[model samples]
Target: MSDASARPKKEKERGKGAGAPRVTARRPTLGHKWLRYLQEVRHELSRTQWPSREEWIRATQVVFGLLIAVGIYIFVLDSALSFVIKGVLGFGR
Candidate 1:
């Protein structure tokens, strides 16, 4: 390896008194953190492209149709399995 690659990286320096204790990074208060979050949310909201009502309705219908199809498939499979189970267990009686 090269000498540059073998050398260790230097860390960031913190200004503290020579005789005083070292100061660590401080976290923001709850209210200040919430305010900062709201600012970020508003900034993102300004850049969003909202879909039209008709587009939303069409998307909703597509999702609903897929859900209904899946539900019916599960119901049919469950009923078929139940019938098979009953037939197999009936010979014991």
Candidate 2:
């Protein structure tokens, strides 16, 4: 409940605009922003470490193996549920 907290903070004056219209902050142009983004991307990419061919291949194999195992598990689960539902409803032919 201090007076400082209740009152708004004052902005510092810049370049003799006491009576002049308030000047808005300047923003970078579109081309300048794109160029800066590309520069940052290049900097980050240079710092990245790529895996060896053997390591990459092993990781890819692991991902594919897990995908196949999950597919089989889902198929088995769906088949079992379908069989149970058909038996309960006497819809099996």
Backbone clash count for every predicted candidate, in the order shown: 0, 0
The candidate scoring highest on TM-score is: 2
Residue 80 in model 2: lDDT = 94
Query: What TM-score does each of the candidates earn?
Result: 0.65, 0.68
Residue 67, model 1: Cα distance from true site in angstroms: 1.1
lDDT of 2 at 75: 100
**Can you write out model 1's per-residue Cα lDDT over 60-82, one digit (the tens) per residue?**
99999999999999999999888
Clashing pairs in 1: none
Worst 10-residue lDDT window for candidate 1 reads 9-18
- Using lDDT, give the best candidate's number: 2
Tens-digit lDDT track of model 2 for 14-45: 34545666779889999999999999999999
Which segments of model 1 are wrong by more than 4 Å?
1-27, 91-93
Query: How many residue pairs clash in model 2?
Result: 0
Off by over 4 Å in 2: 1-26
The predictions' CA RMSDs to the true structure, in order, are: 7.6, 6.2
